[model samples]
Target: MSRLEVVCPAGTPAALEAAVAAGADSVYFGFRDGTNARNFPGLNFSREEAEEAIAHCHRHGVRAMVAVNSYPQAGRAELWQRAVADAHALGADAVILADLGLARWARSRFPHLRLHLSVQASAANPEAIAYWTERAGIRRVVLPRLFSMEDIRTLVPALPVESEVFVFGGLCVMAEGRCMLSSYVTGRSPNLDGVCSPAEWVRYGREGPMLTVRLGDVLIDRIPPGDKAGYPTLCKGCYRVRGRAMRPFEEPASLDLLSRLPELMAVGVRAIKIEGRQRGRAYVERVVRAVRGAAEQAARGRPLDAPDLRTLMEGGRATEGALARGWR
Candidate 1:
C-alpha cells in the first residue's frame, strides 16, 4: 500500500515549526486576514511569517500549503486575488482554494503553483470533484466531512486527482462552507467572513452553578456544574428543541481516526489532514507526532500503537466522525 501523507495544521509560525519537527509531510495554514477560513485574531501567519514558515518547512523537506479558501465577497474579489498572488510570491508549495473564479485566476497567473480544492467547496462526489479538478488543474481535493467508508472506497479510485480526508480535530455538523446556523445567531459568515462564532460576540459567565455561553443574543449552551464546558460554537451548542433540551446538531466531541489509519490507506486515500488551524503549537506537536508515528506504522503494515489523545480532544471526547457511519 502507498503511504498516506500526514498533512498537519500550522496556525502560527511556531505551530509550523512544531508540525515540521513532528514529522508532518506537509503543513497547511491560512493567511491572517479575511482571505482564509481560520481568520481569527492572533492566529494564522502574516505575509512575513508565511515566508518564514515556508522556508522552515522546506529546510525540513516538508511541503507548505497556504489556504486562500474563503469565498470572495462582491466587489472584494481583488482581496482574494491578492491573497493567491501573495501565496505564490511567498513560495507556497500549493494553494488550497474553494471559489471557482479564484481557482481559475490562480491557474492562469501562476501556472506552476500546485492547486488543492479546499473542503469549503463541498465536493464529495465524482462529478463535482472532476469539474473542479479539470477546471483548476487541481492536484488534490480535501473531501468534505460527509463521506462514509463505503462512500470513500468507491469515490477515491474514480477521481482523477489525489484525495485528502480529515482524520482528526473539529467536526462540522453541516456540510463545509454551507452552515448558516452560526450566521443566524451572529450576522457573520464563516465561509465569507472567515470567523465562525467570531470571538468578539462569544460571551461566557456563571449562572447559579451553571456556566452559560452565548453567541450574540442566542444562548447556545449552559453547562451544569462539574461538566467540562467547550468553546461556544452555535451548532455544537445545546438547544431546546421540541420541548426537550438536547444538542440539536452535534455534541462537543472531536473527530479522532488514529485507530483507522489503515482503513483510510486501504481505501486509496492519498492524504489525511488534521484540522484546527486555530489550535496552538503544543496541539500541533502532540497531534503531528502521534499521527506521524501511526501513519508510519500503517504504511509498513505493522500494528499501530499510539497513546490515547482524548484529553487533547474537544470537551475531552472524540468520535470516528462519519468514517464508520453517517454523522446523524
Candidate 2:
C-alpha cells in the first residue's frame, strides 16, 4: 500500500516554509483576498509571495496547492477567475475550488492544470463527487469533516476520484460551505467572503470576575474568572435554551485523529489534511511533524498511539469529531 500523503496548511510565507521543513508532502494556501476560505487580515499570500512560496516548495520537493475556494460575488467573478489563472501561472500542483462556475471556467481556461474540489464544495455522496469529476474533471475531492470512518470506507471505493480527509485540526460542526450562522451574526458569509465570525466584529469585555465575549453585539459566551475564554464564533458559543446555558451546536475544540491513522490508511485514503491556515508557523510545524510521524508509523503497521497535542488544541480540548461512533 502507498504511504498516505500529508497535506498541511500555510497562511503565510513563514507558515509555508515551516510546513515544508516539517515533512508535509503538500501545503495549501490562498491569496490575500476573499477568493479563498480563511481570508483574514495578515494571513494568506500576496501574488509575489505566492510565486516565491511555490518556488520554495518546489525546491524542497513539496507540492504547493492554491485555494480559490470561495464563491464569487455577483458582477465580481473576475477576482476568482484571476485567482485560478494566477495559480496555474505560478505552477501550483492543483487549484482547490468550490464554486461551480469558477470550476468550469478553470477547466475551460487551463485544461491541463489539475483541479481539486475543496471541502467547501461539500461533495459528500458518490453522485455529487462523480458530478464534479465527470463534468469538471476534478482529480480529487476534499471530504468534509462530517463523515465517520465507516462512511469513508464505503465512499472511497465508490467514488471515481481520489479522496482527501481532514485527519487533524479544528472541527466544524456544520457542513462546509453551507453554514450561515456566522452570516446571521456578523453579516459575513464564509462561502462568499471566506470569513466566518470575522475578527473585526469580535468584542471582549469584563464584568467583575467574568469575561464576556460577543460577536456583533450578540453575546456568545461568558467565562468565569478561572475558566478559559474561547474565540466567539456563533456556532461554537454556549447559548441559553430552556432557561439554561449550554452549547447546543458544538464546543471550541480541535480534532486530532492520530490514533485512527491506520484505519484511515486501511480505507484507502490517498491524503490526510491538517487544517489551520490562520495559525502561526509553530502550529503548522508541530501539526505537520506529528501527523507525519503517525503516518509513517501507520505505514509500518505499528500501533497508532494518539499523540499528546492538548496544548495545541483549541481551548485545550480535542475530539475525534464525526469520525467516531454516535457523533450525531
Candidate 3:
C-alpha cells in the first residue's frame, strides 16, 4: 500500500500542534476572516498565528496547507489576494483555493507555491479535473466527497494532479463547498462568506414538547421530546416532502471512513482530509490520532481498530456517507 498522507484540520495554533503531535502528515487551516470557508468567530488564525502554525508544522516534518477557499465578493478581491500572498510568505506548503480568478492570480504570483483545488469546485470527472490541472497549475485537487471508492478507483488513475479525498468528518448532502443552502435561508453564502448557518441567525426554541428550530425566518424543523435535535443546517433538518416530514436530503451525521483505508489506498489517492476547522483542539487531537493510526495500519495490511469519535462530532453519529455510495 502507498503511504497515505493524513491531512488534519487546525482551527487554531494549538490545534495545529495537537494534530502534528497526534501524527498528522499535514494540517489544513484558514485565516480568521472570510478568506476561508470556516469563518466562525473565535476560530482560525491571525497572520502571526498562521506563521507560528506553519513553523510548528515544518519543525515536526508536517506540511501546513492554508485555505483561501472562498470566492471573492465583487470589489473585495484584494482581501483574497492578500490571503494568498500571506500564506505563500509564511511558507505554507500549499494554498487550497476554489475561485478560478484567485487560482490564476496566485499561480502567476507565486510560481513555486503549491496550489490545491478546494472541493468547492466539485470537479469529479477527469475532464473537469484536467481543466484546473492544465490551466491553473494546481498540484493537488481535493476531490469532492461525492465520489465512491469505486468512482475514485476509476477516476484517480486518469488524473495527472494528486488527489486528496475527505475520508472522515462532516458529510455534505449536496456537492461540497458549492451549496447555497445557507444563503437561501440567511443571505450569507458559505461559498462567498466562508460561513455556514452563521451563528447569529441560528435560533432554537422549545414550544412545549416540540423543539422548534429556525434558520432565520424559515421554520426548518420541529422535533418531539425523544427525537434527535440536530444542529439546524437546512440540508440535514427534517423537512416536509409530499405531506410527510422526514429527512429527504440527509440525516445529521458526520463521515467516519476508518474502515475503508485500504480501499482508498488501493485507488491511488495521495491523501485523506479530515473536515472540521471550527472545532476545538480536543476534537483535532482525537481525530488526528485516530486517522493517523488508521493510515499506519492500512500501510501494514492490518485492519483499522475503530476509535469512537462520535463525542467529537456535531450530533454524535457518523456514517460512511457517499464513500459507500450512500442510499438515495
**Candidate numbers sorted by lDDT from highest down:** 2, 1, 3
Arrange candidates by TM-score, highest first: which order?
Answer: 2, 1, 3
TM-score of each model, paired residue for residue: 0.97, 0.98, 0.97
lDDT of 3 by residue, 109-163 (tens): 9999999999988887899989999999999999887777778889998889899
Candidate 1: where is the Cα deviation over 4 Å? none
- What's the residue-level lDDT of 199 in candidate 1? 88
Q: Score each candidate by Cα lDDT.
A: 0.89, 0.91, 0.88
Pick by TM-score: which candidate is best?
A: 2
- Per-prediction count of colliding residue pairs? 0, 0, 0
The candidate that achieves the highest lDDT relative to the unseen native structure = 2
Model 1 gets an lDDT of 0.89
Per-residue C-alpha lDDT of model 2 across residues 202-287, encoded as one tens digit per residue: 88998888899988899898888877655677878989999999999888888888888888888888999999999999988988
* TM-score between model 1 and native: 0.97
- Residue 198, candidate 1: Cα error in Å is 1.1
RMSD of each: 1.2, 1.0, 1.2
The digit string of per-residue lDDT tens for model 1 on 1-328 reads: 8789999998888888989989999999988889999988899988999999999889889999999998999999999999999999998999999999999999999999899999999997899998988878999999999888888889988889999999999988789987877777787777878878888999888889899998877888999988887677877888888999999888888998888889889978999999989999999899999999999999998898988898988899999878756564
